[model samples]
Target: MKVVIIGAGVAGLSIGWRLLQAGATVTILDRAQPAHGATWAAAGMLAVTAELEGAHAAERDLALHANALWPGFASEVEQASGVPVGFVRSGALLLAPDAAALDAMRARGPVLDAAGARALVPLLADGIAGGLWAADEAHVDNRRLGEAMTIAYVKAGGALVPQTAAVRIEQKSGAAVCVLTPRHRYHADAFVIAAGAWSGLLGDIPITPVKGEMIALAPPAGAQLPGPVIWGNGVYLVPRDEGGQKLLLVGATMQEAGFDTSLSPDVRDQLRAGAQSLIPALKQWVLADHWAGLRPKSPDGLPLLGPVRSGNIFVASGQFRNGILLAPAIAQLMADMVLGKTKIIPAFDPQRFAPRFV
Candidate 1:
């Protein structure tokens, strides 16, 4: 079977990798170089427990399953590519620096506690009044992971077409035939639409673009910030394995504005200052690098996965804030569905957004 995966982000590479394992001939198409989009800017924090708070039961279960698969998946990819994905089991710290935040955190402690929080993270200071230790969760060096995925995809007999913009997906006889590119066309038995924020741009997808800005900083003079991911009031401070350069991935403001990845000083300063409020240790980390990416978002805050109304057209976008965390399981499910193994995740099916299909 010749499977064509559009967009070479983590979702695309993961799908291609799985399809290759299933003995499918895979071809990946991307507008830019593989993994250059949101995957490049991701913090690589696989902190499911940390993100589980206030999430619906279904969402939490999905996150937990994905996190569980990560260790084995990372190990397999490392063995195949001979490069570590930098999986960190240090756990995530959810600190509450103020009274209101502390109160809210305490309310959600039981859910995180059940996810092995206490065993995974550090105990907080007494006066701080609130914290959760999500122990089973982990983090990864996303940059290396992206590179490894793309490398492994190509090395496994998969074809990669860089700088090829997929202009449109043409559905005929209720099945996807071939995607239109700038200068050529390639037919496929199956098609996976895993384009990040661009998922909705494909004519009928319901996904939207939510802008996210992140900054990397050199750790304080004392050394690295020892943790998986630090989530306080307004920021997510994720540490990088590269020496003491910590990634201050902060202020994921949910904006409906279309595809503006350029970082604003206002957003940057606000994010940096927000991190300072969370972990006081951040007051010393020197600014290192800054970037922004668009998240595939939706009004309902749920990812649009599963099949499209048209045949051979599947979606795995609208992940919103859980794109990185959901990568493994989403790809696995996509492969399973493509192989006719089981019913896809029902809620995420694109049919949900279709008035007639409903």
Candidate 2:
């Protein structure tokens, strides 16, 4: 089968890889370089248990299932691309700043006393009342992962066309037949719109861009910010180990700022304060980088998957914050649905928002 996927972000690249592996001819089109969107700026937290507060049962189940697939998926991508994506199973620490917050964390899962939490994360602030430890949580270097997926897709004989903006899906006889770009029209047997926030622009899907800003910090010489992803005070501190460098990703300020990717000094300062409150030693760390990206969010906060009006045209976007964590499973599900092996989950069905689509 010939498949053309729009958007070369993690979702698109992942689906492309799976389809190509299944012997389908694949082409991925992107308006910019691959992984240059939310995938690039994500903190890469695969926190299945840590991020389930507002999630429904199906969403939680999907997250857990996706987290379970990460180990093997990471290995497969690494083997296929001959590149290390830095998949880390370093667990996660959820810290509460006060008694009320501590009680909330306790209600969620197994929590530790202040002493215990500090034991695990030595850099934790003394004022922390208590928290939880999610041992199964993990993270990956998303940029590296994106690069690996791109390599894997190409090595598996998939095509990637960057700088190509897919303006619309061309349908004939009630079936998607081609995609129209400014310069040319590309035909394929199947089309998947995995364009992140831009997915709504194609065919009136109700996906919106939630902007998030983040900062990266380099640990001071001979001192390391220890243990698991740290979640405290509306921010997360994710440690990144890349090429013998120990860096921390401090983020993020979530806002309904549309497609704007601008960085604000006030937001950066707020993030810095959050980080220092979690790890005081971070005060000495160097401010390395800061940026923003737009997360494609659905109204219900779950991904939109499965076919639209056109059977062969599918929607696999609206991953929001968990896009990096959910890439492998989302890809597998999308590939299966496209190949007629499985049906879309009702909760995540694109038709759930049918009124908006119409």
Candidate 3:
């Protein structure tokens, strides 16, 4: 089968790779370089228990399933692309501000006292209540993962067309025929709109862009970052060793600012403050890097998966903060749906928010 997937973010690239592995001819079109969007800008947190807090049942199950698949998925991508994506099982520390909040956190994992939390990281602030220790939490080098997926897809015989922005889907006889781009029309048996924050622009998809800003902090001389991810003060500090430099990634400030990715000093200070609140020594950490990315969010705060509106055209967008974590599951499910091997998941159906006539 011939398949054309729009957007070349992790979702699109992974799906294309899966389809190619299944003997289907796949072509991925991206407006810019593949995986340079949210997939690159993400903190790469595989916080199954932390991220899924208050999440609905379907999304929770999907996240857990994806988390379970990540180990094998990382290995497969690495073997295919010959690149180490820096997948780590370094767990996470989620701190609660008060006793009531600490009690609520117990449902997710073991509750750690303030002393215990400090013992795990040794960088945590003193005047803390308690936190949850989620041992199953993990993280990956998202930027490296993107590069690896791109290489893996191409190595698997999939055509990747960068700078090819798909404008619209051309349909005939109630079936998607091709995707029309500025330079060329891509004819295929199936078309997928996985264009991250831009998915809504192409069709009736209700995806919107939620902008998030992040900053990296490098420890001072003789100081080192904590081994596990630390979450509190409305920020998550993810430790990463890039090229032998250990840096703490402090993020993020969520805004309704549509498609605006410019950095702000005020936001940077705000992130630093949040990080310092958890780890007071962060005040001495140097600000290494600051950037922003747009997350694709739906109205219902759930991903839009499977078919868009009863045609071969499908959508695998609106993953919001979980895009990097959900890539493997999205790829497998979308590939199965495209191949008629599995039914569309009801909770994630793109047709859930169908336009109604007044």
Backbone atom clashes (below 3 Å) for every candidate: 3, 0, 0
What residue runs in model 1 are displaced by over 4 Å at the alpha carbon?
A: 98-107, 110-127, 220-222, 243-251, 355-358
Q: List model 2 lDDT by residue over 81-169, tens digit each.
A: 99899998998988888878888777677888899888888777788987888989999999899899989999999999999999988
- lDDT of each residue in 28-101, candidate 3, tens digit only: 99999999999999999998988897899999999999999999999999999999998999999999888888
The positional error of residue 246 in candidate 3, measured at the CA in angstroms, is: 1.5
| Tens digits of per-residue lDDT for model 1, 150-230 | 888888888999999888877677778888899988799888888889977776777778777788777656564556676
CA displacement after TM-score superposition, residue 131 of candidate 2 (Å): 0.9
* Candidate 2 TM-score to native: 0.97
Best by lDDT: 3
Please report the TM-score between candidate 3 and the true structure.
Answer: 0.97
Q: What is the TM-score of each candidate against the true structure?
A: 0.90, 0.97, 0.97
Model 1, total clashes: 3
Clashing pairs in 2: none
lDDT: which is higher, 2 or 3?
3
* Local lDDT at 247 for model 3: 89
